[model samples]
Target: MKLLAVDDARARILAEIAALPAETVPLARSIGRVLAEDVAAVRDQPPFAASAMDGWAVRSADCPGSLKIVGESAAGHGFEGRVGAGEAVRIFTGAAVPAGCDAIVIQEDATREGETVLVPAIAAGRSVRPAAGDFKAGAVLLTRGTRIDPWRLSLAASAGRAEVSVGGRARVALLSTGEEIVQAPATPGPFQIYDSGSPALAEMVESWGGTAVRARPVRDELDAVIAALRDADAELIVTVGGASVGDHDLVRAAAVVLGLSLRVESVNVRPGKPTFFGVLGDGRRLLGLPGNPASAFVCAEMFLKPILSAYQGAPTAPATMPARLAEALPANGSREHWMRAKLTYADGGVSVRPYRDQDSSLISVFAASDALMRRMPGAQAAEAGTVVEVLPLSRA
Candidate 1:
């Protein structure tokens, strides 16, 4: 079978997916959720001309002169009467500016003697915040596809939105396979090791805004793999191990038995060439990842992250940036290479240093990497300080 380029494979996988349905969630709990609809302001921000500071509201023309102190205006309570000539109104921050008042004299700038106050000359509208200054009624402050953060939530709250419509979280089932693997906290046989990749992948799924359902480790038997796949109730199923064509690889064969239609047969990338994606008969998507810890991680960053983003109506491409290489590198082979690397920021620029050991099973090396340096297929040798594209690991 002809190997698909990494970009081609990603494109094919994304073509079959769409954003999940929208659901309403409280504004307080909408953080990290993608907006399903535009959020409009219910009313003008401030609602009225307000005082920006705790000061005296006065007419600019009456400043630098002693004036009669009028009624006070506190937050949620406004002075019913307007300020007339030779008069000032005591106000607090966020309070409505009294009618006929165009300037404010801070307490420090004036002296109060019972009902009479001495104020200094001040510019008009110096401390008065105009109504609708921040946003107007019916204005769209937050748009669809926006990811809500604390700052965005505050904006929505200011817009009088107690709840917001956001995309439903995508449920992903993580199935780890291999007869040579065992769950942690259980003593492993001499030939077996504790399963480490699924735990990290589950966290990565959550970080990428998906709900991960981790299944117990399945043996390398075809019936067990088939049973696990059939029982996974999720929109997307991620299988670790059993992706290669070796005799022990049973995921593809089991998927085939379950009516899988391949969308991506394989990718032309180092450490993840066996990665594949397909759609099952029941409409769930399946992504097959190599068992090696580094390989699964690299493939997850390249493919799984984007899939989750697409499911949430967010941008589907990895955000890659250019950085200078801290060490020289030999020419790349036919397949694209994504090398684990460390990044440093200095002199107003980013520098990346690829680890010397590029072995796919080295979990320690991958744990120490903060970025992935991309080397195109058939790329020529590069010297130190050469500019290269890098994808930052968010967890790092």
Candidate 2:
């Protein structure tokens, strides 16, 4: 297959994507979750006309003159008596609007003398009558697919929601295959290597609230690989490494042998061009991530992370920010590049310094970096001051 540009490949992959339906969750646990249903206010935000300042509430007409104080109203308390002409009700912040009150005169603008309070004309001039529906009642307050950030949580609490519906977590199976691979703590001779990608990938999935059960590692044998792929109960299977054209590369061949329809053979991107994606004969998803540590992670973010988010009804894409280059980036003319980098803010924008070692196989850069800077293939060089897009590393 011919190489596909990053945008084309992304569009193709995303075309196959759909967010899962929402599920009900307790409000307490719903923070950081996505809303599966549109959230409407059960009632007005304040529910009643309440004071916004720590001042006296009085009938606006009675202000600018001394009025006999009928009673005092504080938050949670209501003044029962109606304020007649030349009469006032002393009220505190958040106090219910008294029966005949139209506005509030702050305490600073009032002089207290016994039961009568004198409110300055200037204070009366600035008083405001909070209108009904200052915040609408029974209106859509949050949209479906909205992620429950702190503000959303507060809004839900204000809207009197004890529980809400959200998208369910995604389920995935993580598999890594190679004959030379051994579990960590196994002393490796020069030829034998540790299988660290599966564990790391599993952790990444779990951080996103997705369950990533580790499939048993199989030797390079095709039968074992196919068997392992079939054993996973997850909605998607993530296979690490063995995606290239080397004679040992069995993932692509096994996928074909299993009758999985290939969606994409490769994407025009550096560190992860040999990526593969398909659907198995049984309709299970198959994703082949490049073996390089960086490439594997980039593929996971580009493909797997979005899938997980959609499953959970994540409201938006992963956070991205404008970052300046700390060092000159050589122009990429062949494939879009995802450079692992550390970010800092100096002037008004972020500055990204690429990791010294950009080798796809190195794991230390993944650990040390906080962000990824994207450079499209055939794009011009990024000067030290050019603003570029940065995808923050997942904290999960």
For each candidate, the alpha-carbon lDDT, in order, equals 0.92, 0.78
TM-score of 1: 0.89
Candidate 1, position 44, lDDT: 98
* The 10-residue segment with the lowest total lDDT in model 1: 309-318
Scored by TM-score, the top model is 1
- Looking at model 2, residue 188 earns an lDDT score of 76
Q: Assess the local accuracy of residue 352 in candidate 2 as a C-alpha lDDT between 0 and 100.
A: 90
Instruction: Give RMSD to native, each candidate.
Output: 2.6, 4.0
Q: Which candidate's lDDT is highest? A: 1
Tens-place lDDT digits, model 2, residues 1-396: 667776676556665656666678888887656788888877776676777776677767655898888888888887877778887778877777777777788888888899889985544423443534445777888998777877888888888899999888667988788887877777877897888788889987876657788876678988877778778787788899888888888888887777888788898887899987878888777788987778999878877777677677562344678888888877777788888999987776678998977889889888889898888778887678788898988553
- The segments of candidate 2 whose C-alpha lies over 4 angstroms from its true place after superposition are 18-22, 29-36, 60-93, 102-134, 165-168, 179-200, 203-209, 216-221, 247-249, 309-323, 344-351, 393-396
* Total backbone collisions, model 2: 1
- Model 1 misplacement above 4 A: 346-348, 364-368
lDDT of 1 by residue, 1-396 (tens): 669988989999999889998899899888778899999999999799999889899999987899998789999999999889999989999999999999878878889999989999899999889999999999999999888888999999999999999887899999999998899899999999989899999998987778999999999899999999999999999999999999999999999999999999999999899999999999999999999989999999999988988898875777899999998999999999999999999999999999999999999999999999999999999999999999998752
Model 1 / residue 168 / CA error / Å: 3.4
